[model samples]
Target: MKKTQSCPPPVRRAALYIRVSTEEQAKKGYSIPAQREDLEEYARTNGYAVAGVFVDEGKSARKRYTARSAFMEMLEKVKAGEIDVILFIKLDRWFRNIADYYEVQKILDAHNVAWKTTQEHYDTETTNGRLYINIRLSVAQDESDRDSDRIKFVFQNKVSRGEAIFGNPPLGLKVEDKHIVPDPETAPLVRELFRHYESHRSISRAVREVGEQFGRILWLDGTRRMLANPLYKGVYRDNLTYCEPLIPPEEFDRVQELLKERSIRHNQTGRIYLFSGLLVCSECGRKMAGRYATTKRKAHNWEYHLYRCPTAMQYHRCPHRKEVNEEKLEAWLLEHIQEELNAYQMQWEASASAPVRPKVDKAAILRKLEKLKQLYIDDYITLEEYQTDYQKYRGKLDAEQPKPQRPDFDRLRTCLNAEFQTGYTAMSPIQRRDFWHSIIKEIRLNTENSPQILFRV
Candidate 1:
């Protein structure tokens, strides 16, 4: 027989990964040098070449996977088949949760990469290794449970001492040192906002003028958010947990009552009133009532009934009474909207200075104004492009930055294009609903001529 040559053992190029959550600092013994030294020596002894170390330092393991940049990058390279093995000091050094550990293990296995640890030795490719890993994971889970109990104890002790653990101080309130201190720069403005809202009545009237957060003028939605914020009342609300009050909810409660008073004064409820008991019959003095309402699905709601007085339609009869179908009434209202738009267009045309088109790059403005920071990792654009766009966006973000108009009809047109691409015919239903409520008042009809729609002031 010919002499048989000895074959070399397979080379294992391993990447070391280490993670230490807040609780592990005490229990897991997750020191940077200690983990590195153990993993490095373990890789060398196992005939594996140590390539690189990925460390997720001081980050919570419970956090989303993407939150740990190095961990995520390690997975990417593993899936790319760059590393042949992953070595860690121990199983807990690898992961506290079974789901996360298994997910990463499967990815490494798919790429033909093996995973091992110094204390909990598991190869994943072998049944014995898998059994060892299962036991190690159970032990790791026990450690996690103990760590959680310790944290809860500490948190309860803190709460007992009246040491406030409010998530974030409200605007116009700064954490000077540790305790929340009133910010002189914006406190007065906040107080003024409440006063203005109280006196002005409608939130709409005070939205652009409310001197809140250092004279910060608000749009309708922003103003609503500010008003609804419980922090202004000095109460710290972290979801449902109510902590010590900061300002005093009573103050805001009074302001809310004032707002209701103003709303009633303006008679600006969505409900419409035309000839509301205004045209009383000369005969019996029973007030006339409107009983007709129409919906698009089934036109004349009044087909079943009429708008004649309940007394007139029923037992009590009065002269000068006429009945009309609510469905026909609603259709006539649509025609009035077209008429009003035509009249407004003619009036604008007669004006000497035509409303000039806005200079804002509507598409670019909206795209740049988006919450780019939130989409940082999800967006796959080049880093250079992201930086350039972010800088451009930040420069324009300053309130002092010169801008004549925020958005115009041109931007609305762009919005339409974007909406159509998602297999929708028009803007979102939300957009349509908001547009109608903001631009036009309720359509009015007394079962007579066309509808007369009053536009918003």
Candidate 2:
């Protein structure tokens, strides 16, 4: 027989997964590049082909796999049969969550995939190895939990000592030597905002006037938060006196009373907004809130129900300042109901026939927003650029997505019939409100005071 030529074994493809949480990087000096180099060397020494490297920087191994984009992508590649095995530096680097590890391991098992840690020896093929892996996972998770408890204790101690926490100080204050001190530039504006709100007792008016006077962009929610914040009264958490008072305690107390009183009055109002939660502002993609406009005509007060963009009125960031009269909108809807229904049916059919679109990753977008805020605080980008990018990302967050349920077309048709019109007209204000809410999803109001109705369908 002729001598058989020797053939080398096929090289297995390996995917390297690396992760370093912020705390780990700071405390343990865990480096991604170093891990990558070591993993590549391990692969080379094992006679394996390095298929890909996935790194999740500033991400904890305990986080959900979905939240770790790189890890999720690696799983996708494994599912595609591109990866024979996954390699990490240590067991802790692979997972700090036992449940999450098993959840991912199920997928790996189904795909006949395996994972190995270069610095640790634990194989799934043997009972002892599997038990050792479980013990390591438990230890890692316990360590993470303990680390969290310690950090919380430290923060609480700092707060009790009237020291600033490790984050950006609120607006109108700056961090100085681990203490919060007034920023001369914005402190005066904060004082003015409180004084204005105290005197006027109107958050919207105060925010608008203060923003205009100081050339600053003040949002309604932020302004309200500032007014109610105990920090302004030299108190933080339960510390009683955290810093120098921006607004006197008496003034702050009085403003709190005004805010509470206004809120009670608003809640107890007799007026009912027919489309309170069903109107959207076309310009800013924010909800259009209902308000009443009162005028004195012939010595008698006339109250008109209206819907307007609260974002524009309160934040002054949006340009859609025009208000839509509720009566006119109702009349317009009555006249165009048939046409709108037909158009909606066509659109619904078209959408049903079209291919499904991938979902937008809302959690990822929120994480990005937080990162952007941190970047702005670090002075890595200018205010204008930050504002522009912030708005762009916010718009994406506000964009409409597909709804799960279709509209009740049969009930809608019945409600629109001439015979049912009489019954609808006879319904009380509350009943009408309920009926409209049950059938209409939203109505987009443009700057021209026109309404674009979107039915529940």
Please list the C-alpha lDDT of all candidates, in the order they appear. 0.57, 0.81
* Runs of candidate 2 exceeding 4 Å displacement: 1-11, 193-212, 216-240, 244-457
Q: Which candidate ranks first by lDDT, i.e. highest?
A: 2
TM-score of each: 0.44, 0.51
Q: Write the per-residue lDDT of candidate 2 for residues 46-94, one digit (tens) a residue.
A: 9989999999999977678789999999999999999999999998888
Best by TM-score: 2
Clashes of each: 6, 0
| TM-score (C-alpha, index-matched) for candidate 1 | 0.44
Model 1's lDDT to the true fold?
Answer: 0.57
118-165 in candidate 1: lDDT tens per residue?
875456667987787777777777776766755654554444333445
